[model samples]
Target: MLSRTYSRRVDRVQAAVDALELPPAVYRTCPFEPRELVETGLRQWLRCCGAAMLDRQVIGMPSFAVDEAWHGLILCTERYAAFCRRAYGRFLHHHPQGGELAGSARRAGSMAEQLRRTAVAWSFVARPGEECVLWDLDVRVGVPEPWGAGTRP
Candidate 1:
């Protein structure tokens, strides 16, 4: 069973999805089982939410991390949302565990002070699914190296 916080987050994400005004058919074909779909969606949703809180801009054109990092220093909610939707459509492609994704977001949020001082920001990109990457102002530092390779998620 999902925790209360997780469940609430899921509800919010679902609400956001509904607000997108997309047809039901878009969500109906999720490749995962119903339960798994919800789990994956929750993670992707949180990732999107996290990215939305950062300073970045959404781009209509998709590009590699290197290019994206150089394009802007601000985060983009539109890009994040579209990425989440695409990840859901792809059945969570390279989905990480829901707990890990959520926890990472929480950790990132808690590091506001560090981020401001280090000239760093975190964001999520679809890459066809959710992937967490760190940016040093305008340079792609790299993905949160396995969550503990000399850095916290």
Candidate 2:
């Protein structure tokens, strides 16, 4: 069952994501078709992150397009910081794939393992009728060369 706080944070995160406008340059860098679907996927992932904030879990990015969308959001420092405060009460840090801390236990997982955790986090926070496309968002959105190959749905 979802705690009231977690539910509220998820709602706020979704709203923040909805309000964001990813610039065209972002798409130019990580091209994908059916922009709406990719955007929706990104929103859902962020909501999952918000929900999992207290758990201190690592939610991996399973799609190149969604990752790009996140990159765009992060570039908007003020808006992203404000949105993070509203959604999770703290800034959600992004650790690039190869930049894990030297001995940090939290960063000690393979990409596949991280993606599996992401799926599990989504299971806990997904809305009643919500369906996650993140597992295969790259291929679904026709990313030229999808990033995630071993991700489990």
Candidate 3:
């Protein structure tokens, strides 16, 4: 069973991340349409990432829009760092595959494997009856090369 304190903490962190105002330029870089949907998905993804940090899990990003939003957040170094401390008691680092840290334990696997892990992570953090739209967010938003069609992450 989960304690109220834990639940409240999750809620508080989710609310804080959702309230974050990402740079306007981020929407331009995202390869998705309907800014509203992208923003909504991005916030949910960010909240999940924050919650996943509690268990030190390496949750892969499945949506380009969400990834773009994350990039924007990281650009605001001060705010992103402080948000991490408040939400997860530490800084959430981004270790993209093929980067200098490619061999690091934090580096994610192939897209298929990464998406699988993302789905599993979502299972742990999602609220009851909450449907995850991240897997097919690209398709739903009409991205040219959608990553997955009916997948859930």
* Most TM-score-accurate candidate: 2
TM-scores, all models, native as reference = 0.21, 0.83, 0.79
Alpha carbon lDDT at 12, candidate 2? 78
Separately for all candidates shown, the number of backbone clashes (residues 3 or more apart, or on different chains) is: 5, 0, 0
lDDT of 1 at 40: 35
lDDT of 2 by residue, 12-129 (tens): 7767766766666545555677988877887888877876676787777888888888887787788778878877778988888666677653564776777778888888767789
List ranges where model 3 is wrong by over 4 Å: 3-8, 100-102, 105-113, 150-153
Tell me the tens digit of each residue's lDDT in model 1 across 3-118. 67544544555455444433333334222224233333333333454333332312111112322221221133355446456423322222122534555544434333433422
- Name the lDDT of candidate 3: 0.71
Q: Give the lowest summed-lDDT range of ten residues in model 3.
A: 100-109
lDDT values of the candidates? 0.33, 0.76, 0.71
Best by lDDT: 2
Model 1: which residue pairs collide? 55-74, 55-75, 56-74, 56-75, 57-74
Over 4 Å off in model 2, which ranges?
Answer: 19-28
Tens digits of per-residue lDDT, candidate 3, 1-153, equal: 668876777777776776676777666567567777788777777777765665556676777666776787687789888878776677888876665364664455466666677776666568788777787788888877665565553
